[model samples]
Every structure is written in structure tokens, then in C-alpha cells.
Target chain A: MNKLRETLREAIVEAGVKDGMTISFHHHLRNGDYVLNMVLEEIAALGIHDLTVNASSIFDVHEPIIEHLKNKVVTGLEVNYMGGKVGRAITEGIMEKPVIFRSHGGRAGDMENGSSKVDVAFIAAPCADDMGNLSGKYGPSACGSMGYAFSDAMYADKVVAVTDHLEAYPLADVSIPEGYVDMVVCVDKIGEASRIVSGTTRITKDPVGLRIAYLAAQVVKHSGYLKDGFSFQTGAGGASLAVAKYVEEMMEKEHIQGSFCMGGITGYLVSMMKKGLFKTILDVQCFDMEAIESIRDNANHQEISATRYASPQAKSCAVDSLDVVILGATQVDLDFNVNVHTDSQGYIMGGSGGHCDTAAGSKLSIVVAPLIRARLPLIVDEVLCKSTPGETVDVIVTQRGIAVNPKRTELKELLVKAGLPVKEIKELKEIAEAITGVPQQVKPEGRVVAKVLYRDGVEIDTIKSVK
Target chain B: MKIVKNAVAGTLESSDIFIRVEPSEQLEIDIESVVKDQYYKAIYQAVDEVLKEFQVANGKFSINDRGALDCVIRARMETAVKRGGEC
Candidate 1:
């Protein structure tokens, strides 16, 4: 039977949406996405209230959510990450109910274990057939890898496929099968493709960023884990991508062939696979058009579900096979606990997506950041929020010096012997403080605004409202 | 040095501060910053020190900072004061 609907409103009514129910969306379209706002507006216009929006992540494009949160149309937010104006409002405690923050893996795990319930899930299919078979690789709004939507579609009581491009029945390249979807609604446009995925990402040209990348690459060179069959992951940030560039150069020079690269796949990683440096790319998300093209055409680039990407409940995940992962941090304390969840001012601007998951799973986890950002030092006595625990973090790389976790004495020895500048984490803190001076600790004295959960479903930290 | 006319210096970019000076009956410094919570007192002190160095007591010194360092704050303050007229 056909599952086409006249409009999103019709789909919502047919899906049986009610007050206090939970609705979900995926963030594959990122800042360009129009579906989240569109669906939320429709739900609000229907006079639904006290509903929770369980999104994979929230970006600046979703700033309209602030009005919904204020009007009580949406009272709860459960997300893997939050940023932009919505993040600032959350930190200011606009909603009475605290937002729930989870890692990408933790979110998938919770959905699977029946801990996080979804009443209705709206999947923004870039291309869909009349029967709701979906493909993200064909439409004008195409965003590769419908990875984050799998758990939502599989677990939600009702699933609605929202699409701007509708094809005939039995679509050949189906990313999400018709069995999981219940209704299909056609729209004029789903998102701006340019913003959903970058045409290309550039490596940092800043000298400081280049220096940190060089040292981090050197750390990998001597870590004894950089040889053949290596598996790696890195964030799409400038500094982290710079590290990948250096590592790629070294891999080419040494003729090392890595087994695979996992997690959020970027154009640079696509280039690496094309150059035969890595045999395969296990992509949970695509960061650029190049990655989207690769996933659509190349056999070696395989799209993976978030569960297989990092879920703790999974029998095995790609992160467990990672040899190294390079990450970025807003702040790292003397204990090496990272706070990617908040800024120096205690504002909630980010969250642990797969940060702690990869850090815990990888054999080598390196956090690369500047020692001082503006007038604020990167190393402090305590982080504003502990998004990732120090136990899993192995190294802190900066342009000035690198600090190895005390537990990794052997790794420290290897770096030192290799002529890499190694120093105590405290020493790095001191150096930063000497330049910026001691900034007065601004403790958030208001109520708790959000709860941060580890990939294992443990509450690692709570972010307080900014006073 | 004495207060003269309205003048401005610096920019609103990151690691920088925007400073505006206007002649007034009393010395007043107003600061708006991304790091105001932690660096408010430090920024006030820096501006006060600059005022002392210039020997100007009565002016409205308004600053909009995007986490500028001490050096940046001081330099911008000096430039604004100098551009305000004779010093």
C-alpha cells in the first residue's frame, strides 16, 4: 500500500501526536536543515504543548526553537549537541526542564534499550519513493549517510518520511528501507545543500595550528601504533584536520596502508581512501560533498548506522577498532578532563557527540588545542564541565608543549626520546597563566541547566545555568 | 591632557576590543565583553591605569571587548585617548 500524505500536518495528525509525547529528527542536514523548524512549527500550530524534541544535534539554523521553548510548545530538549543562540538560551535557563545531553553512541544505545522513547520520528529524506524507500544521495538537498536516523525510525511508534524529491515506487538506491517508514510527505525543499555539507574543508593555515598538528603527528609517528593496519578518527575542526593532513603526509612517505578510517568522514579522509592510504571508510556521517559523492559511488566508502558506529550496547563498534583519535577541547583541566560542552564563560555551546566514545574506545586519544585562546587559558584547575573524563584521554598537544597523561608513562618516554617537547600538564597550565594572568573563576551559581551522559549511560557531569 | 571630542579606536573582532571616548563631567568606564564575568575587574584596572598614564580624569570610556588580551586593551585605550585630541 502507498504511504503518501498530502502534507506534514496530515502526517502529524495521522501519526497520533499528543501533548507530552516525544518527537525526533536527525541532524544530517545540519545548519541548512529546514525540516526540524518546519515540523516543530506545524506541531506548535496544532496547539500541541509540553512535547520533547529529541534531535541528534541542534545548530544555529534551529534558533527558531527558542520561541517554541519560551511559548511552552516544546518544554524538553534531548540532544547529542547544542550550539548557537538556542545553546545560550539553555544556559540562561529559559526552560524549566533541564535539557538532556547524550553522546552519539549513548543516544543510540538508549533508544535500543527502550530507555529513550520516541512517539513520532520525522525523517528528512532527500529523495524518497511513493512507498517511502529513501536515498540521501540523489536529490538537490542530498546529505549523505542517513546514519543518525536509523535508531529513531526503528524505535519510534510512528515514522514519517519528509521529502522534497519524490520518485516512483521501488527506488533502486535505498538508504532506509520502506519497512521502517509509515508515512511520506512531500515538501518544496528540505534544506540548503551547500550548508548541509561543505563543498570542501580547508586545513588551518595558522602557524600555531600547524605547529600543534606537526607535534601531534610526531606523537603518532613514535607511538608505535602508526604502522600498517592502523585505524583512525578525527574531528572536522581546523586544528584536528591539520593533524590528519600531517599524518597523511607521513603515511604516504612511509608507504603505510591503514586498515580503515571511522566516524564522521570528511573530504580529506575521502582523499586518503582514494590515495590508497586507508583501505576503507566506515562513515557514520558525511562532512562534505566529496564524502557524499564517495559514499554514493565508491564501494570502499561504506555508510554505517550510529549503533554500529559507536553504541556501547553493540556487540562490536568501529570505535573499538580505532588505533587513534584526534580531538579538540574548549578546556582541559590538570586532571585531563575535557569540557567541550561549554565555553570559558560557562555557556553551553557544544556537547559530547562521539567525543568520549572514541576517546574511550581508541588506543590513543590526543586532544589538540591552543594553550591560550584570546585571554583565556586552555588548561585550568577544573573544567566548567567534564564532557570527557581524563581516564580515557592519553595526550594533550599544544603549540607550546605536549602533556602526556601520567598513566601513559611509556608513551611519554617514547615521545621524549623522539625529541618531542614533553612537559607536565601543570607546567603547561603555568605557562598559559603567566601570559594571560589568572582569570577569576566564574562559577555558574544558578540551577542545573543540562545533564551530560557518558556513552555507558552514566551521568558524568551537570552544566549549571550561567548567572 | 584634557577631554576633547568624541573619538573611537579598535574593532569588535575576536582577540580585540572596541574603545570609544567622549568628553564628560566625570571619569566613567563602561565595558561589554564576552569574558566580562571573569575578566571584568582586570579590564577595568587596565583602563584605569591607562587613564592614569594619560593624566585625564573626566571622560566616558566605553569598551566592547571580544576577549582581548591585556596588551590589546591597553593599546586600544591609548589609541582612543590620543585620537580624542591633545595629550
Candidate 2:
């Protein structure tokens, strides 16, 4: 008995997609994703309306969704991150209901707890068999880890495998087994391979960014967390990437071996693992092609499910084992509340993917951002939206100074004792204000545009509409 | 105050606005922006505040905005108005 379908329409019919039902998609393909749009277009053509789309993330490539939202084809959106194009519309109060913004861990947990019930999950497999055995590590559109799709496949009532490349039966290296998937359909092209790793994944060459990175690495080294068996995670931002580089150098200089490096894995982390800096890489997603290739070939590079990666409901997740995690912030308030959800102008551009989860789970959560961006201060009295609560945040590193959370008194003392330029968070705010001047607060107008959820599924903050 | 010659301020950066002011019979503001669809009113409000502060009665102000914050927009308009009034 074959589970393969001739067309996506047939698979959609077989998956029992109906109006007002929730459908899901993962962003492993990132901006290169075609499955979400393809599936939605088909659904729209079939006269389906009021469908809620539960995607892991939405990128600029998914701008076609603006029309879908306008047409009432997709009335609700639940996501971890959103790019500015679609996000701008949401901020303009385009949808009737506010979008549900969840953290990566929160999304996985919500799916498992039945809070976010996905009726059908469309899995964009890079490689799959007739029986729906899938892997994102092969084929022309290989995207590396299928981590975010794991929960959807497991929890969704119907799972459909949409693939560009279909192999023979009983395919090896299965990321998701055949039992979970209900139907498999071959497509012409799932996504553009080049677009999968589009942004700058390299270390920053800018002096100011590098200085922040250098100081961040120093803070980590002296913070008492950088010993043998240390585990680390860093974002794909320029400064964060540079921090990873400097940390690797320090590890090599000290000859200290670490346990693991996790999060959206990059080639730099792969290089560190190769150089014996870390024993393994717990990769939930691959940031670049090198990481994709590494995960494909290297045994130390292990792909993990979203649940095992950072789900709060999980008994033991990789984030809980993390010693240090370097993250980026659009703005950080004096209380340490981070605003990754919106820009200083209250426009929705980003959201907490795993920002809150890793911060809460890790021993040291360091937020790295420049003091000023485009003539505006990065530190403010209050964040525009609280994407990650201040209590979970441990330290903030800026180009001008480093601010340790007051709760971490020992860490403050350690950094101060190490002769590091550790300053109070208020001082950092002052320094930023001095440079950019005390700007008028941007008051968002209109109704609520989105709800930012904490990793535990609590409504932490609400992003108001930008008028 | 009235504009005499064309004057421009600010760079066309991601978070900046470039304002071009020239002499006109009436206050005419033409804004071409990436964020004009969602933020035209806010941008107009920022321009109006700057114009009212400087008391510029009539000028053809062309704004090319790139998602600049209100403060930056005000500063840029202030600089351009000052320069435009000088000539």
C-alpha cells in the first residue's frame, strides 16, 4: 500500500483540509520555502477560507500571504518569527484578530499540549520516499535539520510530505519515519537552495561590532562558566558570530574542551567541533550551507527535535544543559526586558524564536547589541514589547559597556573583579541616551497587532498596532 | 521663515530620512518612502512638528524616508529648513 499522491490537491483532499481548520508548516527552508505558499495557493484555489496558518516562521518570500490575509483565506497566523514585509501589514492592523506569537519552545510545547491543534501539517522534505520516510539532509534543496517539523508531524492529525526529490522505498537516514506521515506528494521545486542561507553568517569585520564580541567573549571566559565541559549557543547575528569566534580562540588557547554547542548551528561552530573545542553540536536548525553539509557528513553534528531542543514541557532539553548563550536584541530596557518583537518605532519585524527559552534555560544568557543603531539608542527605559522577560536575562553586552542583571550579583562581581568594564544597566542606558539624545517615546496607536507569548505559553506582552 | 533655495539633509540609509526643501507658494509635502503605506501619517506628523517649530509657512518639501525614527526625521527636517531659509 503506497501513501504517495499524484498531486498536491489529491494530498490536500486526502489530508482532509477543510475551511476554518488549522494547517501548519515549518520554516526549515526559511526564505527559500515554497511549500507554505504552494499549499496555501492550492487551498485558496479549492475555495477554502478562514484557515489558520501555524508556520514556525514567516520570511520575506512569503509576501504572497499578504493577499491571502486580505482575502480572508488565512484569517489567523501563529508563528515564532516574522519578516518585516508581512509583519508590517500585521502591525497596520490588517487582520481582524491579533497574530499569536510564540517562542520556539512554546510552539513545540503548545502543539504537544493540544493548545495549538494542527489539523494538517505540510512537511517540506528535501528528500523523501514513496512511503513518506523523509530527510532534509539530501537532494537539490537540502536544508539540513528537520528539527522544527518534528512536533508538527507527531502532533498533527494528518501529516503530508511535500517533496522535490523522491527516492526509492525504505530510504536510509530518515529524520521523520514513515509511520507519522499520511501522504507524500512530489513537487517540481520545494524551494530555492541558494535562498536557504541568504544572510551574513560570518564573523563581523566592523570594529565596534568586533569590540562588543571581544568583550562578550571575555565576559564569558571570566564569568566562571567557561571551564571544561562548557556548553554554548550563539545567534546568527554578526556580533554573536564574532563572539563564537573569540570564544573558540579562547577555548583553543586555554586547551579547554567543551561538551556541546547548540542552537541554529553554523559552519563556525562546526569548525570549532572539528578543532576539538566541543565534543558535539546539538543542532536544531542549520544556519548556512556549510552547517547543512556538516550535519550531513559529520557524526558529531546531531539533529534534534524542537521538543528536545528547547521545549519547556520536555523533561530535559539541550537548552537546560547550556552554560552560555549569546543573543541579539533590537532594544533592551533597564529592567533587561528584550524587544525582539518590534523595532523602536513599534513595527513588528522580529519575534522571540528561542530567545526566551534559551535565556531561561541557560546558566548565562548574554544579550549583545550596539549602544546605538541608526541614530537611535538601543537601551531604553522600557522596551516596546517584551519578547523575553528581564528576569531570565543575565547580562547585556554593548559596544560601550556591559550590564549584568542585578539578580546575578556574583556574576557582576566576577566581571568587575576581572577588570572588565562592567557598568549598571542604568548607566548603559544613560550612555546610549547621551549618544543618541533622549528621544521621544514611540507610542503605538490602534488595537493590538500581536501577542508575544513566553516559553511557558504565558501572555508576556502585547504588541500594539503601528499607525 | 521662507525657503530661498533648494537644500537637502540626511542620508538615504536604512534608518534615516532625506528632506529636500525649496521655495513654494504654499506648504506642499511630497513623501516617497518604503514605509509610506503604513507610516505616512506618522511621517507627516513628524514633518508638521518640525515645520511648526521653525514656523516655515510655505515650502515644497520632498521627503525620501527609509524607516527613520521620528527624532531623526525631526533633526533632518530642522537641518534642511535652517539651510533652506539661509538662502
Candidate 3:
């Protein structure tokens, strides 16, 4: 054990991670994680300099991380999504190394295949024994599943556990075994579970959101998809769930029925199964109580793992056979390129969790989003950061109008030919820029912060933070 | 986006994946399509089975095909109906 400890530190020193080695972080935190900032401060106290911080994903709570990047103490980054002020600084082209982004599975695959290796992994365990048996269930900051942390802990060269409540020796209910752990540190608290949930997972009650839900239903209806025994997947958000409700009513009215609902299983999704719309629910991860209960008791409600969820290598990945996927976007460009990466100003706070996979595999991938955000347009000339390429995105639904990929000129022509509210993308961009006033200049430093990875596991783009 | 609420009933159209509906009523749907090329057909068959089971008139319905297999379609549609009551 002593040798292992000494070897880890020695490896860090030998690997040229002296004061400014590029360090990496992973976001299983959603918004409640504090490990990144806390570890960075501790590293800084050790006199680390010129450090580049790379995380799987960054969130709004991580705004303070940008200050490290600007200080030259932290010099690089690699994350899935960029939002808020940090993204703006990067879009202005402030950083040099283009930020890199990747799909969630792709990131895991890369790390597994040794493409993206980490020097140290700072994982926050909700429940971990002193000897390093870690699970997210026991800790005060339990976030249910540690699905995101699996890769980091397994692949990182040096794995460190930061937790507040350490259990007895030989920790029970461990997701990350002690065999991979290098060190254990106890803190007063990891973070607040409420903060971890950041955005409300509830379905939307707003009239506009409800209106969009209705519109989305119409598109599905007119698309010639409405029928008994249909299969589909929507996000777990309010609008997505609300669409299920509206569609349920339609089923009753039409006397139509359906079969299965797949993907991230939530309570809402479970309700659908229980009501007999679907004969069963194929779930990978349960998002709430109803889902958990359903998984435990309902034979129709099943649980799946990440590999079965979208893994190309799986016998039959859930995504490969999707018919239609409804999604959300931060911005949709004219080329049909979608940006869930950075905001108008260029900060990253999101990740590509099967976004590209579903878009690429689904028969019809529909992105439902308002045309503008905070008075700024959601459609831009060029994405501040490209998470999902335009090629994969089929339909872009804005509050003002909807646009289809020109590649599907037939679909575009069909929609326009249908006389639906369709308009040229340029008109939408101009209207947005008109109100936002031609967005101010954003400067990015000449350093790569993150990388964008295609569903096929190819590097797409690299992002840099502004100086 | 739309005013009336008919699509959710699952009578609107059929696909392997999704079903359609409007928001006039609490947004509820019983999507039964599967992740298969014949997902629409599968959903159609599953709905027939559900109606036989529930004894409701084949009722108005909308579907959003997702390319699911027959078993998967039956599962989703049943789940959709079970939960459709809440919303």
C-alpha cells in the first residue's frame, strides 16, 4: 500500500506533471460537484502552475474554473459542453488549442481504448469505505447512479476518492472497487444534492411549452407516424413528458395503441407502461422514484446499462433502432448544425449524452427549441461550439418556425409544401442578431480546452478558453 | 405550437417510434411503436391486443415510430397507456 502511494506521486512527478501538468476532471456532478474546484485549489496550494484542466463535462457551478485557465496556472481544457461566460471567451477565439468534445460513450470508449488517458481522477463518492469501495447511494450527496464516474475511476492512472462519510473497512455496495483506488481523503462535505439536480426535471406547465408539445405532436402525427404499437423516445424534461400526455389523449381519441418505450426510463415513462400504452418499458437508467419502483416490481419495466443503451458494439444497441428522437438544443445554425455545447457568448455546461448517437441512428431526429434565449437568438451563423454536427440533425423546430435539413430537401419541401410555419434559416438568424445587436467580440486564448467527438469516435473540433 | 388535442389519442399516424397529440387536455399519450422497420405494424397489432384486453373501442391514437421490435412496441404502448392517466 505504501509503495502504491509512493508510486502514484512518483508517476505524477515523472510524467512531467510537476507544477502545471494538464489535469482532467469528470462531471458526474451535474451541478452539485465541488471536486474540480476543490482539487484545483489544493493543487495550487502545492504550487502547481501552467495546469490545463480537462473535464468530461463542465457546468455553471464551474465558472470559477475559467479563472484558473485565464491565470496561466491552468492552460488547457477538454469538456463535452461549454456554456455561460467561459464559452463566450472561447467563441471570441481566445484560447489556442481548439476545445475537444465527445459523446458520452465515445469519451468512455476513448479512455477505455487509451486514446484519452488521465493523470489523476478526483471522484466524489457519496458512499465510500476508507479502503475505497465507492457507490453513490450512501453519501449525503447521493445522485442515485454513478453512471458517469465509471469510466474515470476505471481508466484514470491515479484514482483519488474525495468524500465526507467514509464507511467501515471493505466498503459495502461499492460501484468503484478499492482495487483501483490510490488514495482516500475525507472532506467536510462533497456538495448539496439539491444543487446536483441543477435544473428541475419536472415536465413543463408553461403555455408556450405546452404549445410546443402540441406542435411536436402534430409533426409526429402528420409525419405519418401516429398509430398503434409505435415506439419512440423523448427527453425526460417537462416539454418532452408533456408531449407524452398530449399523445396519450390523442391515442384515446383515435383509439390507437402502442408497444414499447425505450431509453432513460423515468417515472413518467413508467406511468406510460403501467397505463397499457406500451406493453413494456426498456430502461437503462431509472431517473426517479416511480422508475425505480417500476423496475423493482413491474415486469414490463426493465433496466439497462450504458453498453446496451447506445453502444455500437452491443448486440443491438437501443439507439441503433430508434424511429424518432425528440431532443433540445442550445442553438441551431443555418447549416442545421446544432450547438448544445456553448451559449451565444461561449461557456460550456452540457454534455453530448447520446445526443449524436440518437440523432444519427433515429429515423427522424427532431430538435425542439425556442428560437431565442434571453432575447438572443438560438440559431447563429456558426455554432460557438459544435457538439452535434448539422448532418445528423434532421429537423430544427424554433418557436417562430421550423427548418429541415436541406439534405432532406424532400422533407423540407414537403413541410414547406404542407404550408406549415416554415421560413429560411437566414431570416431567423437576422432577426436574432437584430435584437442581440450583432454579438460582441469574443476572444479565445490559443489553448485547447475540449474536443468534440463524433458518434463514430472521431475528433471533430477542439475548443479554447479566452485569455 | 398547436391548439387542439387529437394526436395524443394515438389515432393520428403510425411509425416505428413516436405518436402525436395536442395540449388542450393534460398532455397524455399511449405510444406503442417499436424500434423496427415494421414498428408501425407492430404497434397496430399491439393496440389491437390492448383493446382486446381493455375492451375500449380501438379509440383515437397517435404514434411516433422509434424502430422498436414487436415486443418493445407492445411494452411502450402499454406503458404509455398506464401513465397516460396521470397527466
Write down the lDDT that model 3 would get: 0.64
lDDT of 1 by residue, A1-467 (tens): 76999999999999999999999999999999999999999999999999999999999999999999999999999999998579999999999998999999999999999999999999999999999899888899989898999999899999999999999988989889999999999999999988999767889999999999999999999999999998899988778888889999999999999999988889999999999999999988999998899999999999898999899998988889999999989999999999999998889999999999999999999999999887899999999999999999999999899999999999999999999999999999999888878989977979999999899888999999987
lDDT for each candidate structure = 0.93, 0.91, 0.64
Interface RMSD, one decimal, each candidate: 1.0, 6.1, 18.9
Ranking by DockQ: 1, 2, 3
DockQ of 1: 0.74
lDDT of 3 by residue, A1-467 (tens): 43122223343443345564556665655567787777776666556776666676677777776666666566677665555556665555555555667775566666666777777777777777767777665567665456556667777777777777777877645667888876777777787667654343677877767877776766666565668767778888888887777777776678766767776556776777767777777664445545545665666665444445665544566677676678888877788888776544455556577788778877778888876554346776777667788888888776666677778776776676666776677877776566434543343444665677875678776555534
Query: Candidate 3, DockQ to 2 decimals?
Result: 0.01
Task: List model 2 lDDT by residue over A313-370, tens digit each.
Answer: 8888889999999998999988999999898789899889999999999999999988
Q: Report lDDT (Cα) of residue A334, candidate 2.
A: 87
lDDT of 3 at A419: 69
Which residue ranges in model 1 land beyond 4 Å of their true spot? Answer: none
Which numbered prediction scores highest in TM-score against the true structure? 1
Point out the higher-scoring one by TM-score: 1 or 3: 1
| Tens-digit lDDT string for candidate 3 (B1-87) | 222323332222222344443333333335533222213343466656754554433234466554333454455555544444222
| Sort order, lDDT high to low | 1, 2, 3
Tell how far residue B72 is off in model 3, in angstroms.
50
TM-score result, candidate 3: 0.67
